[model samples]
Target: MALTLALESSSSSRGEGGGDGHGSCRPRESMFEKVVTPSDVGKLNRLVVPKHLAEKHLPLPGAAARAGGTVLCFHDARGGEAAWRFRYSYWSSSQSYVMTKGWSRYVRDKRLAAGDTVSFYRDGARLFIDCRRIRRAGVVPAVPPRQPQQAFFFHNQQQAAVQPQQHLVVAPRVVVVDDEVEEARRRRCLRLFGVNLELELRAEPLLLDLQL
Candidate 1:
């Protein structure tokens, strides 16, 4: 008596034993014979690089791009909602090349100075595209923007103005975990150790905006 067996083959090539007899479940994506060309690279930039003027430079005849000391004047992802400003001297010193095909939200709102650099990365023909500010746009925020230290001061004043939590003593007692085994496990998992622990942390939540 003979038993029949069924197998799933994912190899790109069709050969003996259904999969070159290698008995490997090749990645399905590899099996897909998608052809990549200059046009395809351009499409990737049009997709992930976000909608901008510089993306127009994609399909740049390469799979990727790399630029040195490119100033990130503003990036929706790189900077917070506010498009921060940077020192002109920093970028000027690099003498870097800027990508010109696309302009992201940063370029539009920050009104970056001409000579600002932004490099675009993509697939296929367009990999690294340079962006530069041929002209300034929008109202430049300030030579050096204000810091959150002001907010910290305001919060401190308001907090001080209000009466502090009344100091009170409570009877010390042991926590009972009669039927909370799972709860104990969750508490144990979430507990950060030593340096990871904080109580009413005084640390600022975000980075100092570096426009340099």
Candidate 2:
């Protein structure tokens, strides 16, 4: 079956199968992506995977695995193993498949929020998760500009404040060739003598020599 795994929106591509191993192996292509919702990044502490994608791509937990949920190892975008293994389980009450256990830590470290897209890919037995952040128009930075560090000393009801470090701004020095500077000076003199600057600038050496 053809898989729509490209990172591009609504694009599809076929990828070669990889060996079934873990550690340091990157997936050839993405399998599918899900747009994050508020609940996914909220206090729910779990991520709800689409039933179709979960059934097709994720391995179903057996009775033993279901006791606590199967541990699913996932690699980050850089192909490195994620810090924690996610627990995959079917939630009968919600009638959905969700990633639990380590989901909240993943969301926190990745700083994922609603509207961000998370793509899933598999290479052999290794699975990967990549995040694509949605850009917001006219969004201001949360942290203010850093101010100079302050040092305060208090002794015998007296306060002494340390001065802030001085920042020096060095202007760029222009390099001028002596010959070019002299040529420009001569040109200015010629212009003062009613000589056209353009004519002098464009004048051929042979023509100027002849005129001279």
Candidate 3:
């Protein structure tokens, strides 16, 4: 599968993209179209994919609390111990715990390897990832270079939390988002990159009792 793009979401439709070859899009219906104009619709929220992670990063729904914000981040078993770097703008409070991108310093921090579920905590402005309990999936996420054709390490976990107390989405992936981020943020994510990807609007997990 040539290392297909990875996607994470909780709502909306469309799973991760490996390139369907056939472009499948179900447009807006009549009345809904009347109320929402193309321009206004054009200004709707879109997922922000990093330039390096565009085709590779999938916009999926966030996972549930019981399951922890964890998903089987698909990867090509091709590269061994190689650093796969991608870019991202957002990360759930927990996923943002580890260092997104930096030369070093996170030596004490636990890396987000495959199979390992990460727990996050927000002490102040920054979100801290739990470095102790992550069970590595044995595959390492490779980092990219700025010299072009190289891999990037910055991948974003969209900002949307889900309420475990309510009905779950049941979808493999989901997103946790802030109310302030509307379509403007979405367009910027696309404009900042260059390709259009699927987006699902899901709830973020409540930030209460998160002492961990």
TM-scores, each model vs. reference: 0.16, 0.52, 0.16
lDDT of 3: 0.24
- All candidates' lDDT scores? 0.25, 0.51, 0.24
Candidate 2 clashing pairs? none
Judge candidate 2 against the unseen true structure and give its global Cα lDDT, from 0 to 1: 0.51
- Strongest candidate by lDDT: 2
Candidate 1 local lDDT, residue 91:
21
Error of 3 at 186 (Å): 37
- Rank by lDDT (best first): 2, 1, 3
For candidate 3, write residues 1-212 as lDDT tens digits.
13222332222432331122222111111110011122221222221223233223232233432333222221111222333232223345533311123212122122222122222222222222222212222222132101122222223423232334534332222222232223433321111111112234335433323211
Q: Give lDDT tens digits, candidate 1, residues 72-181.
A: 33222121234333211112243322333233222333222222333332222212222322222233222222222221112122233311132222132211111122
TM-score of 2: 0.52
Model 3 weakest 10-residue run by lDDT: 27-36
In the range 1-212, model 2's lDDT, one tens digit per residue, is 32233333222332323322222233345577888876897778999999898888885755733575688877664443343579889877777889989887776666565556677877666567766544433222232111111212122111221112322121222111111232323321111011112222324331211111
Quote the positional error of residue 186 for candidate 2 in Å.
67
Model 1 lDDT at residue 98: 33
